[model samples]
Target: MWGRLWCLLLSVLTATAVPGPSPRRPSRELDATPRMTIPYEELSGTRHFKGPAQNYSTLLLEEASARLLVGARGALFSLNARDIGDGAHKEIHWEASPEMQSKCHQKGKNNQTECFNHVRLLQRLNATHLYACGTHAFQPLCAAIDAEAFTLPTSFEEGKEKCPYDPARGFTGLIIDGGLYTATRYEFRSIPDIRRSRHPHSLRTEEAPMHWLNDAEFVFSILVRESEASAVGDDDKVYYFFTERAAEEGSASFAQSRSSHRVARVARVCKGDLGGRKILQKKWTSFLKARLICHIPQYETLRGVCSLDADTSARTHFYAAFTLTTQWKTLEASAICRYDLTEVQAVFAGPYMEYQDGVRRWGRYEGGVPEPRPGSCITDSLRSQGYNSSQDLPSLVLDFVKLHPLMARPVVPTRGRPLLLKRSVRYTHLTGTPVTTPAGPTYDLLFLSTADGWIHKAVVLGSGMHIIEETQVFKKPQSVENLVISPKQHSLYVGAPSGVIQLPLSSCSRYRSCYDCILARDPCCGWDPSTHACMETTTATANRTALIQDIERGNRGCEGNRDTGPPPPPMKTRTVLRGDDVLLPCDQPSNLARASWRLNGSVGLSDGQGGYRVGVDGLLVTDTQPEHSGSYECFAEENGLRTLLTSYSLVGWPEPGPAKVPSASDPSVSSPGQLVLLRGRACRSRWPQCHRPLHGPCAGWS
Candidate 1:
């Protein structure tokens, strides 16, 4: 009895001491490959418009005339949106004066890159004019452009608060209700500012940099209207997305580092704000901000953002691209997270965070909140109480808002984690479009541009996100500055330092067989049984019911429908000396499929089994002997379906002399001599015993 009691006690103690399972950590990345990769040379449908100017950062789509307005350094071009490179484009050269350039160069700036008229802001001022701003050799200038003739007026407005003096500084603006709302840096060393221009009574952020805006790097801004279903009448609001340095240590909900750490944020202000009456005169009174959490522990820096605003404000969603800064980890990775507009609004309606003077840290406000709610837009209820605008708000409410601009609760993502995460790729910009499938479900098609000049086309699924394909848009790797999508034309316009590229959103012609088409899982494509080809299922295509589409499950096979396709390419024979290493090539069928090798009739190339290993592109065999002289076949398995991808015939002969193993430096060896790194469940389970370390062990495994 004593022994049994002692054993039970020990077991209970062990169970109590061990920590419960931690909350599920955010996914590092989705384990899948693009189904197809089309190089720049094979992309015949893509059109490009190149020019001598650089940094084509700003792009505005004019759907009225089917024109794409490109804002480049010292020039602006109007190209046909349907075909950007079809013919000659209208261009206007607007260079800064020599005196301005001299002054810019005298300030110790690089004349080649920095001292130039880089057009930064471009918006439609009206139906026939465009509001343009540029860094004219360190002197900011804004002017109106004649859209018909592509001509600039002689007079210009002083772009002090409308644009940034340095072309490299972060800036973003939008024109709404004849007012230009802009967020940019004021001067060379000043803190970032958000203000309204081209308005009768323009409001700006408070002068308190630490509490208002601290070293913010703006990415995107947009206007959102209230839904008509709501009972309360509210004003439309403008929201800005950016990354700023933390004002206090551990201020954000998920923050675990120092105060200097940067955090992604979303701030909003009402459009009807008329500034405080006296205390905060000429300053916004309904400004509030909250932190945006992408993932835990790392990958927090915001790189870029895009929005899919629907007719109903509740259905609007914002997608953001994030990466790990050098302060956290040194990996070239990026992640995409999405948030609903209602979730964001809920956070602002929650408790407010205030800096505690006693502890020198930020904490939730414990005092009573002012009436009408601090940082609330003017509503019908406020109007009934004799408050018409922000200027009519009481001083007590304004004082509370001035000190408590940060919200206590952070806005979490829609699915509680990132939609898509990728490693070894840095997404510079992204845009999304909604596509309704024949199955009565709508999927978002995301076009992500990487820093290496590749565009990844991915579709959001009920389970997660899947990358359909990747295309090399540019021959030479260059960062994509702007990406736009035209829904009516079914096209995507990509702007980079080199030029603009116009490509169709759907490439259904690339898939030859029903198996390939269904395996791609592209929402816009369907396998047509009549034509025996994969075709787009948009309204433009006929006979929609006859097309076979199984996006959720890609188990449909060619055997169930039409005749089997032509036989795969003939098997290739390779002759190798005994004791020599050889590599057999095989292409992957799709990213979701797994590849395995079969020798004769049995499975071969089991990891580290009999000197056989799997590589990224193919199978690698070492110490080749006559026993290996047999037919080898590669099979891709997905959704419990096995398909033959490639077949190889390996023949080995006795060596003339002593056999020598190939070294890394051997000129005759072409293989990389490295084994494939497993992903997903296998990789995670294998590394479960180890934790991420600052040095050695798992760090060197990769």
Candidate 2:
């Protein structure tokens, strides 16, 4: 009973262990095969838009108010930050009036019309006020505007100074702190008996000295020192820098001489200080006089100087832009110089002198020369009222910011020297120029622009800098003269010859990461929403299972249809002689199976017996004679089955042996008498055999 119980338990366990049909094995159909398909989902709705219309001279962003201000040759426009669409943030709002346009142009076709050859500069002092200057109308002026209204000031204030001569030039201006500064060229009254020598080119005569700064001929650029506290007695200072020709040694060809020019000088004055009162009262002072050689001919009368803050860490340094002439040709270059107010004051205190060694020094005035002084600070006589010369000079200094070797550096000039981070590129486009920097740990982004319509971005990195990427942000090529990067949202604003452009840094990063992969119909290394990670399609394992199943099914079907046909006909038998040959007939009439023939009882020849051939006749026996006689049989085979014996035959010839003979013991043995006796031999039952005579004599009784 115990053994039987154990056997029953085993049977029950085996029945339960059948595993419930493996839960249908979850077919591979659920995991679809990976086939290459176009990624339409990734590329559905990218947007592009038309940029601004006119070229721009300056770009400023009021982050607090969400407003963008752009300045062009003779126009200033505003844009609301909220109005910016995808790639369409550069729409224009308003333009400067004809009266304001005239200020930018230097050469006018008509008396009352504004000049087209205008030198215009723009700066934003605050959200509501922007300072602009031009050589048109031949006078320097400043105005305040409402940011929301986009309208110019109804009230105008004239500048303190009168227009200097050198009638064909323009002016550039800047706003630093609360003051406005400009760079311009002013002409001097002719001196009698100082006859200018005649040169080969029929040039105008008069030994007038040309300097970067003079009471009559100079422009100033300004910036607010937000990091520094405003002092009680010091005035808000604006700075100016330019290049000029050094004094000639007795007029030997100023053009032929190698060291004929220098980076002239820089001057600073209070915002309220202007004209002759502040200038003639000796209120303005000269800073560093750059001794480096420069070209004087290219910048003799008309030129440009620009300045910007260097680094965000410290605001003490500044960068200046100027044109340097090499071998009589003008090449635009920028200088990164260091300055301190204490160092400038030390030089001014000692240098009551006019000329340093034999080289002509600027900012000096001796009675009675026709040309403007090299570095003297000048202003309009009327605007200088109430300005005190005896007031203590403000300590305003500028310096260049240098970058470490490990840090990425900009390909173009920006600030003093841009810190250069990773993946930054200087790109030229139709909208405006931009310098882009990729996102990093400390800095959000860095941006820069150029006069040739380009924008570049760089990301800060510990090692060398990288140019992240670039894009065509505009429709046409425009001069991108100035640019500003917003601290609030890290957006880039560009000033072009046409207008202003604003680009969000976030948009740039997205475009760079997915643009090409989405376009080329390739598998994207992109974030997967379901998995929340980058994933790749599994192709290898999927293909292996599919291939194996297909091969197995194909093999099973081929074997099932192998042998399902009818039987074939028999093959004819053939016979052959020893010394000669005989013919063996092996005829088959069926096309389904082959036929085979056997000689005697042994397995012999077979032909066309496997359904491969039809209408096979017989086998040939060449030269058949005595020994070529035998029993033959025929059979057929078809498909996988074979026929036993369809035909049989025997080949025969006349036998040459004795049929009858007598024994020698008989009475006839006494004599040579022939005896007749019967002897029998059996042949195959199906065919005939012949009985015939023997060749030699036989002793027998008849």
Candidate 3:
């Protein structure tokens, strides 16, 4: 009975087919801080300017002389540009008077802290004098400082609208012809004032009717191009940016559904405005406003966070930092948007809207327009007609202009797309510098600061934007109040409540490998072959320069290794006892990419494949035996490029407590929080990181 002998032999083979460890998958681990970083130690060679590290809210840089001015609670400092954060920086202490402090304390304000003198505005008054304003215990005050002596050499002036009563209030202003121009709440937050805060000229605000402002939250201001010698027809203009709620007067619409939503807006006033002839005296006759658009199609919104000034040379471009969030919350993501001057001019030059009497609505004007157009600045032609200011215009024309100061149209962004956007980081302040690369291409280097004391260095690319690097600016988490960039010094100055940090534009030396250095995509960085390290020098040979590609993947950038993927990692071994469990990690880098695995030239492990199973931690093998012994490999696939991770060999059984396997997702992928899940590495329902530890299907990693 040869057939009986054959059946018996087959049964023997089955008896020896020992299973691997039962699949006891480890829990997924998470990575919270995965961004590449430059520690503070590298910046040791510096002359640092040190302040009290308390609420340095205002930052002003006189770029012409490289002098930096910082305004803080009860003190103002003038720091050397070269050694800005150095301890020996010059400071002038000017606190609130005893009587003013008492008044603030009576108002329920913190006298020792919040009720002190906080400088809110500091601008160049003249070549030798500086204009500074402070919230003197809720009683605003202004003073003139002598630049030569760095001291406040003049007595304080009563500054109601020139400075905000609350140090935390949002406002913007500029000094023009020795006059302070501002859009702010005059004496209290309830009375919003858009006025020229100068002696002998007074203009107050009304809370209703015309409603020229909606308690405008001011951001920044820029003076229109005005060179005394040149004779231009139009009067100089100063524009301010803010966000306010829409009403029937004019806006996207006074939609009942969007009663709580607010729209970003920009308003401008003529420099030579002298109020109206009879009805509106000492007021801005040319004050007009329009909406700022940075909305997306999916009902997503981008609200202005801050703005950079416009170019005086007809460049017609204005830059602003906006955060994209749910239309209701508006804080999900942040981006940089550009506004065109052409759009501003178009809205101003378009048809005006009128307030309908009985209907209580703002409707497009179909009636006759006032002569020379309402809000038209005093041009050479108007001057020739003997009209020096709005005081010369007829009363009817002035009244019409006042009622219809809001533009009928809105100013949409130059394009719907953003120059730069970040979903992971909440940007507070942003400044950019344009520089030409040695490779013959030019790009803007954006220095964006965050709320948690981090600065993200990014560069604009043709396809999109890439965050090149990030650095910590403070010892603790603090919002970056201001960011200033200096191209001449190749540095970025960051101001926070804790202190100021100066950072280099590039840190090429940190990248030791040629592959990593080129993948950074920083305009200031390039690969140099002379020293073998990632040198900062711009010199690069044509052949070596061509090696860089696909920066988002950090691939295709090594000599003779120009493939789209990286080679498989080196191999290791693991010993498992019979009937024991083991994990084969498959998490690679790039959460954007998924992972897969191959075993002993067999198909992917799945049900019906014995006790072997795929998990987020690694491949878990239960009841190990001789058949479980084989070669196993882990690979990471991202951006359509497949990268080899690591390989391992499973041999004979060993004395076991747990299978000598690690619970960690490999750190090879360079992503933080959690490594990419290897073949069996899986993400649980609650764990997005897929990097937590799994104790036993019953134990922990050995």
TM-score of each: 0.85, 0.41, 0.75
How many clashing pairs does model 1 include? 0
RMSD of 1: 8.9
Could you give candidate 1's per-residue lDDT for residues 377-474 as a string of tens digits?
A: 99999999999988899999999888989998888777666667676678889999998877678888999998888999988775367888899998
Model 3: lDDT of residue 658? 44
lDDT of 2 at 215: 31
For model 3, residues 1-702, the per-residue Cα lDDT tens digits are: 534543443333223212322212210111012235655554534334556547787778877777788888888888877768555567898888788888899999987676888888888898899889998899888999887688986577887768888887777778788777877775774666677866355554333456787656677677756334336666677777776655444324335535566667778887777777676777777877886665331222333343333435364456676655543342355656666666687798888877788876667788888776787788887778878777898777777777887777767655444455454457667777665665455665677777687777776554345677677666667788777776666667777776666677777666555555655666676555544555443444444443243343444455554432345556666655565555565554433345566677565566226766555445666566778788877665543445567777777455455433333443232234322222222223323333454522212322
Which predicted model would earn the best TM-score? Answer: 1
Per residue, candidate 2 scores C-alpha lDDT tens digits across 1-702 of 534543443333223221122322221111111111112233222232224334465556677777666654445655565443344233322334566455444344343433321225445656565654333344434456655556667664443232222233334455444443444543224221100011111111112222223232243344434224433233334444443444422224443463644324444433433222222232223222322111122232213333334222133333222332234232222211223333332343222223334553323433332112212232332115432431222221110000000001111222112222111112221121122211111222333343344444433222212223333445565555555555454355655554555555433113111111121111112222232222222222222212111111111211222222223234333222222222333433223335666656685653333211112433333333444355555554533344443443434334345322234354433223211122221111211221112211111101
lDDT of 1 at 551: 75
**Model 1: residues with Cα > 4 Å off, grouped in runs:** 1-32, 208-210, 227-229, 251-259, 297-299, 326-329, 556-559, 563-566, 571-584, 599-632, 648-702
Q: Alpha carbon lDDT of residue 113, candidate 1?
A: 88
Candidate 1's TM-score: 0.85
Candidate 2, residue 10: the lDDT equals: 30
Candidate 2 TM-score, true structure as reference: 0.41
- Once superposed on the true structure, which residue ranges of model 2 sit more than 4 Å away at CA? 1-53, 73-75, 82-142, 153-155, 159-178, 186-220, 224-237, 246-279, 282-315, 319-389, 392-446, 459-466, 470-476, 506-702
